[model samples]
Target chain A: MKNAYLNFAQMITGIMVAVLLFIHIAVQKLGVILSFLGFKISDPLAFNSMMERARQGLWAGIYICLLAFGLFHALNGLRNILLETGLSPAKMRTLTWLIIIFGLIFFALGTYVPLVLLTT
Target chain B: MADNRPRENSLGIAGWVWAGNYTLERYLYLLHRVTGLGLILFGIFHLTATTIFRVQGEAVWNATMEFLNNPVFMVGEFLVVTAFAFHALNGLRLILQELGFTLGKPVPPIYPFKDAIRRKRLWTLVTLAAVMVLVVFFFIDFAAGGPG
Candidate 1:
């Protein structure tokens, strides 16, 4: 049952990451592509401008959703890799909990900064 | 020999690479694992850096960006792009396989193991080619000092 749940989570998160990452990269590159075409999009490298854009409704939502999916996908993928190393069942359980805690901490940090930046 | 049994001593790093006969499929699996690990590491650094921008203010964020402008860091960024290309493309392939989009329907258990590459070789090649193109594009863009 645990293995089944893990596989299901991996499949779902993997799909989410694949789709969201493409969108994220495309948006990042769109700034450059527009500049090359002489349309004068906002400077992609300008941190302030980027943050300002992130504060907007659509970009902010995209960023937050990306963060949520990315954190879960990455940490879960890492945990799967570690499990392949043939740890004892007890060790596996401990590792699972450790990764879960680590994911929560980092997810909190990741989500907090984006929300704060978006609001303020 | 298509063996499903897990090898007891195949848990080591060298074992992972050397234990199995080298094949395109094995190489793809290895590359996927390595690139996934690389992306995870880079993601950690990125998250921390972005969080620093919020917590430490503009001056520190600018300083961090300046520090990242070093040539060595630029090379690292290139590698990160390469990893991203492979990881993302192969991840798409994996997701497709999981959802039963590409691999053909199940067959009788005469052999009990079907080669995925044989079943979806076209997709494997297409994803690999796509990754190569993207990695080359990113490399050129980075070399030209474009925003990553």
Candidate 2:
């Protein structure tokens, strides 16, 4: 893709990740704060709690979306950083391909856990 | 293939750090890039550890989680929260500016230039305040650690 389109996607995915991550962090990390504010909750990081969340299809969908957006935004940002290092075109292409492959493998691994939990 | 481009102008990765005594925006630019790389590294580690441990079933996964309950990991988690707070807000500012939403009409080049910094000072302050608020929240939540 052209740089313009890539940047546009980066911006869009950034916004999406920000929104989705707010949800993820609030649920996973701020359980104590939420409970303090009168929400009935427990240790969200506990195995049972995490498994319960993973069992839900909605949670799986959210996790999948977060994973996709987060991975792209992150890896692309890394690419941009590396590109600014005055790399040659051939080197840049190689780095881009490497980043894409790494992202794909990470995404496949990440998606599996939630999918398995939701399906099983 | 020896590609000899003019390298004098290119600061390369060094430009991202210790280039000069830059303005607030420039400093934020450095912070943005650094925090971005940091977050990506953290994501890689977190994903790999969780994936490897998780595929082994609940006992193994729980054991890994137990391992992460140490003070070192707790500190790392807190840092992630702090970094996310800064990166997200600064990124919002960057998005708005890049989209030309925050910038007014282009005035002719004149003396006593009212630069973009002046135009964006409000946004910069707002972003910083928001980040500070989030850091405070993270500090509290970290101390509490899920239902304290």
Candidate 3:
């Protein structure tokens, strides 16, 4: 089975998340440098509101990528953990089905919410 | 000297507790759940908040932000951040583990702390450093009004 390969994919997805986090940190640092130069930036909400505008574009993409990989990765990981703990094969199959169903629901919501906002 | 050992803490609760061999997989599994659940909750909140903004408009977004920024909520925010750190870093470790290499087999009395202390220390230090950078950036971006 290609079950093992699934893990490889998850790892790749994780690396992507790390890169996105780095970008977020970099942007924050840039903001700090600007303020240090005598900008009258004091209100955090104002800061965040401005950040959100830029972040909305950035995070929208990041979250979508995470959702794509994490849904499968997490569900599969959960299944493997359960199987390792000695669940019967028949039971494991049923459990996997349930996880898949729930995962799809969450996945749909995740995709829908972001697309809705970006579109509107 | 007779081998009448002092029960060796065996055939009792202690024995039951220490019955099975330990595996690297178990620790990886636990860490995965910890990270997965953290990320899942973060995802839910992020999505729900956005959906609310779509349905209820700016008023709801303001309310949600206000609640999140409250003193009590600030503590929860810290927890969320910590959870994300654990999830993101540990997830990376789990990924490395999945590279088809058996970290050797399970060892009895899986003293992960004693055995993996150096590796753990390395990972912890990296995680801490990452957190520091994140905090510095957050301060500049959010506190110093650099977001704009």
User: What's the CA error at residue A45 for candidate 3, in Å?
Assistant: 6.5
Report residue B120 deviation for candidate 3 (angstroms).
8.8
DockQ of every candidate: 0.46, 0.51, 0.22
Select the stronger candidate by TM-score from 2 and 3: 2
RMSD of 2: 2.8
Kindly list the per-residue Cα lDDT of model 2 for residues B1-148, writing each as its tens digit: 6654335436666665667877889989989988998999899898887667876777987888888888898998889989998999999999999988888878986987888888788889999999999888878878876531
TM-score of chain A of 3: 0.67
Clash list (residue pairs), candidate 1: none
TM-score of chain A of each: 0.83, 0.95, 0.67
DockQ of 3: 0.22
Best model per TM-score: 2
- DockQ-wise, the better of 1 and 2 is 2
Candidate 3 overall Cα lDDT vs. reference? 0.58
Output the lDDT of residue B74, model 2: 91
Off by over 4 Å in 2: B1-9, B105-113
In terms of lDDT, model 2 sits at: 0.84
lDDT of each: 0.76, 0.84, 0.58
Which tens-of-lDDT digit does each residue in A74-108 have in candidate 1?
Answer: 88888777766777768877988998898888888
